[model samples]
Target: MPALGGKIDMVPGRMHGLRVQAQREGRYRGQCAEYCGEQHARMALEVVARPPDAFDAWLAAQAGPAAAPANAQLARGQAVFLAQRCQACHAVRGVTAGGPGATLGPDLTHVGSRRTIAAGTLPTHAATLAGWVADPQAHKAGARMPATRTLDGADLRALAAWLESLQ
Candidate 1:
């Protein structure tokens, strides 16, 4: 408490749930009050507070498949994805299929539309995505996603761009 000057407070352990009355339609963020691991500070949670009608529409859009690649670069990225081991861990609906190991990682169907990645460790951008894909361990210490060091810079950018375009 003294180190923080009492400005910061934390409660460790699992949270049962949360309830809030959103006064306006906008995004609100929350982070874990409990200690998780080395990357605790990077962890983040989001609550998109909106009217019921807008919320319903948002849910529908989120439930839909990832958007198709709209250009040559995106298409190339898609092709690179199909040729990689990414399907073994992650899945991009309509682009990647699930198998025995598909459930190992999170379903990245709408990752592009999300604000953060690596459990909110980094912002959702092409550069960050590429960095994560290249070496997740550098960002998240215990990440299960392996490094894609083999991908050349151009290919990596293409892949990241394609992922960002999934929105």
Candidate 2:
């Protein structure tokens, strides 16, 4: 494969895959060619970019369960989540977060326990989740959910912080 922007020929069966240019300045994108499933188009691609140190911290956090803060703030954050009706499409184990809703999206039962989030687009960090929560379309265009613009400032922090606490 080409390192930067040059074209590289690839054989379907002989070569597993190849990495091309980064979509963004520091991000990359690729697709699976093998037709091994029903939804080939829905397989989707990934774009990831993060500084070395920040990526390291995110990796360490993803390797383990969420480390909740020891304060009333987290409780309030939980309240905020419930009040916002995020449970409709998401599931949080040991909580009444799921119901008779369409499973059109990924489960959030162990969101904080995952390494890369958004189907492996970015590191599963509080800030990333916060940004996603604030503006889903910003990160992924044509996102199913509409942007919940009501969340801001401390509310955003609390909600993101609480969601991250769900290990």
Candidate 3:
């Protein structure tokens, strides 16, 4: 997602480029303008434009380990994440050693910093995160993360909260 006035496209076996200025410091949301396929709706994008200093700080934070859990609930959530083998497909950088999930799935090192989830299909909030954790396909059909039928309501909330605090 480019700034309000920016746009770009990709073509098979071709190269292209476009330059656009970030008119303001904030987040911009956009979606593919062309018909891609059955799951085109899931092809969402977001652009976060920040001042040079802020951007640098953000980048530095991302390069470091995820923030530690601050509460008991969040701690439990972390446990659930590891016990459920979420590390098999997701990584929290310093929290989890490098593995397949580190490359295969979106990195969760700073997931809480994101403004949206499920490829922008839903807002980033604890409740939505919980739902997504329970059943990813429900939010984004054909998602790689299978529905988690083992977690109860409390555990789900804790897990989601933990992820939300990863920033």
TM-scores of the models, in the order given: 0.81, 0.59, 0.85
| Candidate 2 residue runs with Cα over 4 Å from true position | 1-70
Local lDDT at 118 for model 3: 72
Ranking by TM-score: 3, 1, 2
lDDT of candidate 1 at residue 132, scale 0 to 100 = 94
- Count of clashing residue pairs in every prediction: 0, 0, 1
Alpha carbon lDDT of each predicted model:
0.81, 0.65, 0.83
Specify the highest-TM-score model's number: 3
**Candidate 3 whole-model C-alpha lDDT, 0 to 1:** 0.83
Say which candidate scores most in lDDT.
3
- Give all candidate RMSDs, comma-separated: 5.1, 8.7, 2.6
Number of the candidate with higher TM-score, 2 or 3: 3
- Which ten contiguous residues of candidate 1 have the minimum total lDDT? 1-10
- What is the total number of backbone clashes in candidate 2? 0
Q: For candidate 3, what is the total of clashing residue pairs?
A: 1
Kindly report which residue stretches of model 3 are placed more than 4 angstroms away from their true locations once superposed. 1-19
